[model samples]
Target: MTPTSEAELAELISAATTPFAIRGGGTRVLNADDGPILDTTGMSGISLYEPGALTVVAGSGTPVQEIANALKAENQRLAFEPPNLNDALGTSGESTIGGVAASNASGPRRIAVGACRDFMLGVRFVDGAGNIVKNGGRVMKNVTGYDLVKLMSSAHGTLGVLSEVSLKVLPNVEFQVSLRLADLSAQQAIDAMSSALGSPFEVSGAARDADGSVLLRFEGFEASVRYRAESLMKNLAAFGAIEQIEDQETCEALWSDIRDARAFAKGQGDLWRISVKPSDAPEFLEQVQPSKTLLDWGGGLIWAELPSGTDIRAKMTVAGHATLMRAGTDNFAKLGRFHPEPTPLAKISADLRARFDPKGLFNPGLMGDLS
Candidate 1:
């Protein structure tokens, strides 16, 4: 079922008796239980764009690439740098901005700028009860009352079906430079990334490839980028000799591959995205010893690929959460996709769900058993 307007979407949900599997672009594959599918692609378009003000408001179904092109024309961009995971996930569809917010997706730049929720100024969504709700606004200061905007950002379409979204943007940089340190061990890679991030070089991207190479990215005006790159090289000399990648196309392709974790795109094994303190990452890797791993966010975000049916959570001593990003259908049902929330947080989640979805008609079991 595809609704072209918010009113039509509300009416459909209001009249529905069964659960709905809300889909936006269908890029992030999930093990959705059987139910009627509600695709949001029909409800897409840019409603408002103010380049000077650095804001863009679009329908929930607007394609992210479309938004990117528009912002690029204005010398602006979605600073959060949301990743397009279609290739990695093996899904075929446009990557909608709504899906980005729904999953709270962010890329390598998240370490410096922020996550998707930080740039989200406002949102319009239809609650599971079929009521249209609005929060925040086109401008940043327009926030009032409870901050449901943040809540809805990562609710995974369980709290509501996003209809529209307002986001803050940043100007594009004039130049970009990448520094690489080759053949570092896991700890060495983490240390090198940490040292580079700690330096005053404005390291926008810090990641370690599965092949033990650490990449550091800095972007700004040409002069500023050059100055910072030189400073980073000198400051990080203790780690190793830094190789500079100054070619624009080459640097961009490197970051894009890192942003999407393209290494595990077609490999065998279930993919797990682990979030841990940057300092604890080396320990976590030592314990899990996954077949493949990619480190991002200065080692705070770890992507590991393990053999199927391996419970990563059980082998953990580090204080972090591991989310199952790729797995078989039955495994999703048996092992779950998200980490179990603590009792208190679970209660709060249950209360929110009860309030927003009184009929429990939205995507059921999408976030695992919240009963």
Candidate 2:
């Protein structure tokens, strides 16, 4: 069923007796055999954009590229830098705003301004029972009741179908620069990234590629960005000779690669997005030992690409969940996708799903057996 309007969507949901798989742009890591599909692509376009207020309200199926173009015209952007997995996922449909929110997809700059959930101000969604629910406000001072806007995010449509979302935008930085510290090992790169992040240089992006090269980004006015770049180089002198990447085109291209996980595009092994305490990454990497990896989010997020048929959890000794981001059907079925939480936490998650979707109809069991 394709829903072109919220009212129509609610009516469809209210009338349906069988389970339905939710779809928005249909470009995510999804399994198609769940149930009848409810596609939201029929509903598209930005409803309201208050650039002066740094806010935008768009229909759930509005293409992310469309919103990005609109924001670029006003020198504003989604601060969290949501990822576009078109290439990585090998999916043709463009990612939608609602889809991005539902997955809480964040890129390299997530280390700076936070995540997709952090910028979400308000949301309009239809729950499993077909009831329209709205939470939060258009501005940052929303301090009432539960923060369902955040709860719905990263839920992968297990709770509701987002019809509309209002997000807090941010102004573009006047200038930006990256410092590439080469010839360092993984641990040394993490150490440099940690030190840079802990310092007052305002490092906006940090990552260590599989080849052991580290990158640190700074953004602000031209003068400030340059000063910080030089100062950061001096501070990180112990690591190695630092190379400055002030060429706007070069910096943008490199970051775009890291942001999109271009290294793990197609033909790569199964990809996992692991989140752990930034300081604990070095220890975790020593255990999992993936074939290729990308250390990002100042070491808090580790994008590991392991060989096929490998069980990531078996090698995991750290205190973090491993998300099976990309893999073939056989691999996905063999190795569970999401990390199964401890018994206590699993019960809490199960209870939340039951409260929102008693029938276990929304993307049932993909995030774990909430059913």
Candidate 3:
């Protein structure tokens, strides 16, 4: 059932007789189960918009495109540049603000700015008990209790169903320029990206293509971008001949592809999103040889397409976790979709899950069987 209001949403969940497949846009975490569909699309709209203060508050189900358009009109945007994974996931899942938060979906820009949780100032949601809980105020500085706002981010809707959200927005960069270094070996690519990121040029995005090319981006005033592009080239002359993609259109398209990991979308086999230290990225790649790999977040984030049933965890030497981005539930269960937590951390996670979702009513096992 679609809920149009928070009150209605609480009532629906409180009355549900069976398990639910918690869904926001049906783009990510497609369904709760075959039991009942709690589509949040109906509960959408921008309730408060203060462009001057750089804050936009909207219902959880509000379309991300709608919010982007609104922010565009105001010369502001969600700094994280969250990706629309509909294409990447091969699902027509239109991204919603709430869904983006739940997935913690950040893009190439995450290397510089932060993740979705970084800009999230506040959240309002119905917990598993159907109680409406609000945390943090709409403004950027509101803080009076436990940081549930961040706790909910990336929780995959296991904790609760978000109702409303408030976020800080930043003015869109006036100009962005991309520097490309072609045909660098994986280690060379990582080194080149690392150099550009560590320099004082203020890089906004960095990634390596499946073909082993490295891309570094700088965004800011036109002159600043140009200056950095030149400075960055001089800094990395030993890596290779650096080329420039100065046109905003091309630069944006390239970053978008990298952000969504779109190149691996239509490929065969399972897709895994691995997070590791940027410096350790190259070494990690040596252990896990995938059919195709794309590096983003300045080599800190790796997206690999390995054949289904591949032993993913066994291929890692660095301290990092591999998440099965696209896979069957049974295989995920066998392979452990998320990184296995250590004993102490596992205990804390189990306590949190049990306390918040005691009845196991919300998207059962969505966050995995922590207990």
Candidate 4:
């Protein structure tokens, strides 16, 4: 059913007899085997754009690229830099703004800027009881009660059907540069990245390949970026073979690919997204030792594509936190301690579900049934 308005959306929700999953462009939807998908693409629109206030209120179904383009026209951007999950999924689907916030998708810039949850200012959604609810507001400092807007940011549309959203935007940087370090061991590269991050220099992206190559990005005014790059190179000469990528097109493409995890796509085996302490990355990789891996988030995130027949859960359990990226299987990622514990939080989550979706109609069991 096409829900052109909030009341129509709520009506559809109330009439959904079978369990239904809310879909925004169907990018991340195909990741699971949810029943009876309810598409929200028809509900797209931009409700408000306050350039002076650096905030934009848009329909949840608006494509992220559309929002980005709209912001870019005014020299602004989504500070969180949410990733294009569709690219990682190897599918051609529009990544809606709501989907990004709902998935809490963050890319390389997350280390410097923030996550989707951080940028989300407000959300308007229809609960399972067919009630329209709004939280937060279009401004950043709206001291409203409960701050339920953030609660729904990464809820994956399980609690409600997001109809509208407000987000914080930032000005685009003047210039961007990437520094590449080749021929260092994983531990050495991670150490170098950590060191670079510690310095006064503003490093935006830091990543390493399995082959021990490190790539660091710094964005700012041309002079500042250049100066930082030169200083960073001199500081980490021990890592070996320093090369600066100054070409705008090349630098943007490289970082964009990294942000989308395009470099790790379609490996010889199943893919896993692992989050561990940056310092422990080398040791963890050595322990699990996947055949192919790409280290990002300054070694905090590991995209490991393990060989067939490997025990993904067991390996990940040993490595602090892990999630199966893709495997043509039912269970996508196994939750670990890094994920909120399932005791009191689980009870609270269930209570919230009882309030928003008492009948358990919206994407039940998507995040593992809190009920």
Lowest summed lDDT across 10 adjacent residues in model 1 is found at: 139-148
* Model 4 TM-score (2 dp): 0.92
Candidate with the larger lDDT of 2 and 4: 2
The sequence of per-residue lDDT tens digits that candidate 4 reaches over residues 238-330 is: 777789999999998887878877866655676678888998888887888887778888989888877654665565444355665555543
TM-score of 1: 0.98
lDDT by residue for model 2 over 1-371, one digit each (tens)?
A: 88899999888877777777888987876664667888988778999999988999999999999999999999998888888776766777888999999999899998888999988888998887889988877766763433788899889888988999889899987889999988787788889999999889999999987677898999889999999889888899998788998899899888888888777777467888899988888888889888888888988888888887788888888788888878888777777778888989888889898988776678777777874
User: For residue 40, what is the lDDT in candidate 3?
Assistant: 85
Task: Give one digit per residue, the lDDT tens place, for model 3 in 25-102.
Answer: 877534323357678888899999999889999999999999999999988888898887666667776789988988
CA lDDT of each prediction against the hidden true structure: 0.89, 0.85, 0.84, 0.79
Error of 1 at 231 (Å): 0.8
What is the model-wide C-alpha lDDT for candidate 3? Answer: 0.84
Tens digits of per-residue lDDT for model 1 on 126-195?
Answer: 9987899998889877755337888988998999999999999999978999999999988898889888
Error of 1 at 77 (Å): 0.7
In what order do the candidates fall by lDDT, top score first?
1, 2, 3, 4
Clashes of each: 0, 0, 3, 0
User: What is the C-alpha local distance difference test score of candidate 2?
Assistant: 0.85
Off-target runs (Cα >4 Å) in candidate 1 are: 32-34
RMSD of each: 1.1, 1.4, 1.6, 2.5
